[model samples]
Target: MQSTPSYLWSTEDLLGQGATASVYKARNKKSGELVAVKVFNNASYLRPQEVQMREFEMLRKLNHKNIVKLFAVEETGSSKQKVLVMEYCSSGSLLNVLEEPANAFGLAESEFLIVLQCVVAGMNHLRENGVVHRDIKPGNIMRLVGEDGRSIYKLTDFGAARELEDDEKFVSVYGTEEYLHPDVYERAVLRKPQQKAFGVTVDLWSIGVTFYHAATGSLPFVPFGGPRRNKEIMYKITTEKPPGAIAGIQRQENGSIEWSYELPITCRLSAGLKDQLIPILANILEVDQEKCWGFDQFFAGTNDILHRIVVDVFSLQQASSHRIYIHSYNTTTMFLDAVFKQTNIVPHHQEYFFEGHLYELDPNLQARHFCRTTESSPLTLLSTSEQPEDVVGVQYRDPALDFPKLVPRVDVVADCSAAKSAVGAAHQTLRVGQALRRGRELLARGLHWVIGNLRTECSRILEQRRGAHSVLACLQLTEGRTHVLCEAVPAGGRAPAGLDVLRTRLRRVDEELSQCSRSIFDFQGALDGILAELAKDGQQVHEDKSIQQIECCLEKMQVIYKQFKRARTCLRLGYNEEQIHKLDKLNLGSLARRVLSIFQNGCVQQYQEALALHSSRMRKVCEIKKHLKRLSNRISSCSVEMMECQDCLQGALDRLLQTENWDLAAAPPAPSPVPLSQARQEMVLGMQELLEQMRSVTCDLQLNNSIIERLGGAAPTPSV
Candidate 1:
């Protein structure tokens, strides 16, 4: 190791020993820069030169702010003493910070947010660059003091880091044993060593597990069994729960206690924070890796969380003076319920009486916000009838308006097998007939409203253009060009007043084009919002087809619109002689060629653009109409199933009610056997199959299916 001269920069003393190297604080002699140097321990049989070269190559390419910087690499004369120069983090590792507080790292919520954001962002950057920090734990994260005096987090140690595409055979096991994901250990323990085909998602799982530990100060899952307990944990990670489990203390209303693996990791967060976190967390920890949120989501989520923090802080001070008013739509039920139960309405919507002066707004306001429906309702019903509107636009109070309510039904069908046939018979005989009648009537009314709205806008634009054109024609006849030219003979020259008339017509066209563009933009925004909602559902055949058709149409429309935009830009610069000659032959007076060209081009472009956009949008509507054909077929099948389930439910309800009313003490403890309806069961099975097929489609296609919206409605039960 002494043959090659060591580029040693000895300044600060040696710090401590790591698992594989000796760390020292040092400053460069020439540059006067502070850095940390890691000298690897002697390798008995392993090739130190090859290992250090690979590690240095990977380290030099990483440029994330949250990742430690590798300054330089040096090898001793013996070719065994390899030293890596790295950025020095003065604050030290997070493991050191956690050791300070016994109560599971008692970090303030704000500090926790900062740490979490930094770590996720750094890891996300690495993943994007095709690298995975296979070993990510508290010990490997280094914290440094920034200019703002805030602790900055950085991920270190690239010795175990592997290129995402590397397929080399596995050798020595890497990473801390306790923190290893099950898959990692499995690959290491294989009889014939094989390179694991892990993706970027694996790094994310480790980050999630790390955050869970950071928040609660413990691992969510504890492996129970012996020597290879870590392996057992890994098994649980893959086979037991594809998604990471959340740990928390939960209490049942009946005083029974049980452990829940599905607890949201953010359950400890306040209501405001939890509300903001749920969706983002769901995206980050999805079962399907494709749907998982990457670095982009982390930044967006961080901004949202920070905004919420500000609002939360402000709300605390005005908690007493600023009151939250809860209003009900109907007082009749509430009054009656209060008389019997000593409370107003359901617990979730029970009105809170505040000290501040409260005012009631008009009733029957249009519902604009999209909110989740209650547990009892499958559809998110809109209450736009403007009655009993509180300070908020809409009232989402339950109709029950009763307190101390009766027992909620735990099951809809008791004897699933027997109930199916009876339900099918009743549905086909009565329910299907009724639903068909109702659906036809609803479709007719919706069609009328849509057609009327489009016709009115089209008529208005046509009238404006007609009137503008007539005015321009009348000017030419009244003020002949020669007479106008004589009048325009300034002290030295003459021009016709007819030029003014042409200018006026041009200006009018410009105004009309502006209004049309704004109208189209508004329409597009509405469409975008609707599509966003549809994206959340993975199933729904009709929506998938409709969304796909609309996207293709939109892309084509955008191309045509771009061409029109370019033509308009050129016209605004001034019309050439060729365009002027064409207009002159049409007998139109010259009135600022540049302005005239713009008006003429815009007139043509606006109509073309609008037509393209409208035609594309109409194509979407047509495609959706086609999907309705499939939906109709599915609905017919659903009707058969719905009846079967209804019969099963009613029978179960009858038996329970009879037992309660008759007080039959000698009755059998077990309820009578109720079987599922075969026809209804088959119908239900069909809906599940359709839903699964929809899931196989791409994200863009799935959005059109409106699965998210359907889920909240009485959509059929999807197959697992």
Candidate 2:
């Protein structure tokens, strides 16, 4: 019922509420963008202010697709309560998704993998930034419906996050009790000195638990009852294996346990997927933090299921290539069925060859095994009449080996215009597809660079500001010492009037220095807000114009950075002068320049490093553009060649069809000396090849469009 922050307009809807804060659906008055405003009650004291500050700092630094974006922070009311304005995730939290009755049975393996991948990516970014997200439960992972209509999982609620130092141990008891690492819980209860310091591995363990819940629709370890539930759960987490290893206990009528043993079925894991997932889960749930699987290990273990296998198919006679996506577990027959669906080739008349051997139609063997054995060798499809030896013989021969040989040419009737038009349309589609893909990649790379530069800049500024603050504190202490000296001096016998005047000037400069430091801190917050806006704009960059808009935003940020640098430089100089004056009084003037030089050198190094990273990213963007142009030209050439092949085949088919009739009694004279059966078979093969090429083109276009959409761009209209 309380009025929201002045900058935000609260809607009638309350998104959700927690014990410490209540979230409301609100809009940024200035930008007119819908957002969630999480207002924390000042009086509750449930969550400490420092915790909220830590969360704000972490969110401000992170600019990843899989992290909740913090737009702005506002303080209002007589109590000066704090409110966090954040991106509104329409789909709510993953916890809500899992709790839905329709999803109660747990998400499908594919869906679960998508969620897990996003979470891992976000966590990896956090780890790289020296941040440890101690809390990584399902409730903290939100699902946002992306522009492509796919669910994007993001990590939220970073109240328990802390910047980790390599040697410093994290001993504080934080995060949800259920998700807490056993070592952390043990240290809290027993105060054991032997407990090893937990690190990023603790987060991996929490993710493992979350993965188990998402996979099974039940927590692997659950809290049941009594005052000792925490201890019981911690004991289970430390000593027990995953629930997948435990079988149900058989109890007598009196409720005494009769027997218990290992059972795989208890976890509802299909036999085929069990081998792929069990190792990952085991590594994640390992009690020793040192042994726990990190993001890379987890990804490697489930890489096959998590990603699609790319299969390339080449038609022998048509000289056409097609790429297809297939699950690793799909059987050879299943893959063939998919290929036939695209090529429209009859299985009886077609022979698929890979790695110098014909493909066997064994339903029991998995496609993964074939790919592994063949090492992803290209597959060639030949007509039933063709022999592998003949193909080999053709490959071995070179036209230059012999003198220019004359070959007889066959002229046949065909619709050349239709073929030309199709090729032109396909060529245009390829051009558009290439541009979209390049643009998406450029934008992604540019954003990454921008974020990296921004983070580095902000960190440098923050560091400078910290230094300014220290100088100001030292100045105050020096002033206190000067006051003591002035008080101790007996009635102006030796105390100079210049010393009093200098003291007064020093106090005035300190006040100005304090104001400048405050301004720097405020600017940092403002920069965070702008960066969040830029992130949103980057997502919706559908056209060149939108891209220009983002460029303008980045330019504005650069201008702001320049101004911040200038202000910090002025404050630093002021601080240096004040320190020099104090040092002169202490007869240490020689060391003043030395100390200032060290600070200046540090700043210079940071600036140089940022510039180097920016230049590297720009070079990458240029390289990607050049590569895209080359790819576009190649696609155009391929389309032209394909069109010519289609034209020749059409002509041959027309000549052959004219000579043959459906009714044998009304058959006409042959237009050419070609046999009817051979002509018919050749025509079928040609048409199948043509169809496969067209399908591949269509698939490529659709894929490009999807990629553009995922990059927050609009898909171009298809030409055909």
Candidate 3:
């Protein structure tokens, strides 16, 4: 047993021990959160400090839900042992889940798919970041039970992880022999001190082996013999046929047993699942790296048979649209429910008319069955009382040329004008009222939509800032560890002066990064306030209020963007400034150059990447602002037209009141006021055009929201 750090960590129990370090279940004193602390021994041959630092750097750069999170790093004891505090997975490792007695028959197909997807996704993320987890194995993968009780598999144990150079070749042999590909095994068996270089494909092979173990509840090739076991395992991996058939046993009267490959357990997989999985396993286990199935191929193949369907919903009344992904087995009602949840449409008032027929959507009927009887056209939803023309008014028609002549012929011009004015006045008043109501609704919805998008973007920015903070903390730890090592050197042979300079520079960089973190917190607070205000029930929607909200969002986005720019400038100048003043004048040494390069790659490069991401998001915000401005202007124009129409109607009504004895039956037929009708028609068309624009902006906001959510946020909870 080892003593724990009294202030930061309180060790509850020893978890496990490895070759280089011992893991303990600990509680973080400040946050009071449970975490797994891996404390390395100072004298281990594994060079534990170096390995821990490298793992920390890699984990800081990679952010994925399916990857284990590195919380903090600390140097403990007089020996300067490194301890890594990481996310605690209460469900243990995947190996434990597979070998448990309850799962002796192997995981269900769905569970297996979940594990496979998560691992592959995590691996893909690593590859994208130019990293290779050279030691991907079942024991390196942990199972975490989420708050909802669903198991999430995360890739961990990055001690063997490496960043690959453009033309890099890995000669070091790492990982468990059982999970190694044939190519790796061949290299490991070479007599020379060095091995041939390998790439990320080795990880795919390990994943395949892990998948096999999970599917069969056994290793693909059993180890036999003592000292010669490695050779035997290599031979089996290279020359033996892949497992697909299971062995059956028969008993004779004399108690003799006969074994045969039979149906009792064929590769320990059901026929349906095997058909889908065997091909993937074969491709992953390919001996040549080039022939292995890449992430995109596996993703495409899996999605094709995954039974998911994308449903697009268009709201005729509100002129809003939403796209949702659902299972093919979901009923029509379920699909409609999902659409309504997103669009905020009341289910009772929802009468979805599609393809010229009234779809009486039964709650129990599957969508697939309903589509079978309908026309093959893509589904377009409409309110039962709404016409196509009502939702999307004729775009090309000139109102002046298209107005109908509604009055009969009249000899007296005065009589005709009076009758025409009466009818026109009534119709104009009705149209003006409708336009005013719809305009207000559109403004409200658009404001709300933009607010939602801003919330998501703000959340993503906060997540990115958190990652940056983690990296900064790790860099500080690296600085501390280096200082400790320097102090250990003999007093007669003082440590290099450049090391002191590096530590000072690191401290300055960390202080600047702390400022950046605070700025992000402020941005988040502002966004939260905006979201809360927007969410208030029955809040009045007016042009001024909407404009004020949009302006506020724009201002905050610009401020955050500027902050990111300033941080990038600080990172670049901070390193270069120090180098110019100190390192340039000193006698150049290899260690000093290495330390500076590490700082550049570790801190400056990461800041650059973050800056680029922020700039990209800022461009999106600019686009949103442009659309918001247009929406505000459109509402203002609509308001002016509505007021004018009301005034005209009021004047006509007053004139009609003066002619109290006007004849009803004997009134001469009136020639319709074509110009007035045309004006009204044009106004209606303008309102429709504004509605279409609102819909387009809403859709754009939704898309950006989804992108931000996927970038850093957790998967959205399915709507009930």
How does candidate 3 score on lDDT?
Answer: 0.51
Give the best candidate by TM-score. 2
Q: Write the per-residue lDDT of candidate 2 for residues 1-720, one digit (tens) a residue.
A: 444455554445777766567778776666777787777765436666677688779889998989989988887565577778788888888888776422434565457768868887887788778888888888889888878888999998877789985334576666665566677756655455554667667876787778777776555554334114445444543555543332122122223222222112323233334445656766777677676766567666656555756466654433333445568788777777766654555555566655545555576677677653211234665544322212111011111121111112211111122222222222222222332333333333333443344444445444433433343344344434434433333332333354455456545545654554465455446546544644654554443242233233333333333333344344233556445433332222122222223223432233234334334443433333233333333333323332333333334323333443322223433355765566455544444444344345445444543443343232233432
lDDT of 2: 0.51
Query: Could you give candidate 3's per-residue lDDT for residues 191-258 as a string of tens digits?
Result: 33444578767877787778877875555544343214446444443434333322212222223223
What does candidate 1's lDDT look like per residue over 208-320, in tens digits?
Answer: 55665555454544444322544543344433443433432213222222233442332223333444544554445443455555546655775556433121110100011
Q: Comparing candidate 1 with candidate 2, which one achieves the higher lDDT?
A: 2
| TM-scores for all predictions | 0.39, 0.41, 0.40
Q: Where does candidate 2 clash, by residue pair?
A: none
Worst 10 residues of 1 by lDDT: 312-321
Model 1 misplacement above 4 A: 1-19, 30-33, 44-51, 76-80, 102-106, 165-173, 189-196, 224-234, 242-244, 248-271, 274-309, 313-720
Candidate 3: residue 498 lDDT (0-100)? 53
In candidate 3, which residue ranges exceed 4 Å CA deviation?
1-12, 42-52, 165-168, 189-195, 223-230, 239-269, 302-720
Reference-based lDDT, each prediction = 0.42, 0.51, 0.51
Backbone clashes in model 1: 40
Per TM-score, what order, best first? 2, 3, 1
Clashes of each: 40, 0, 0
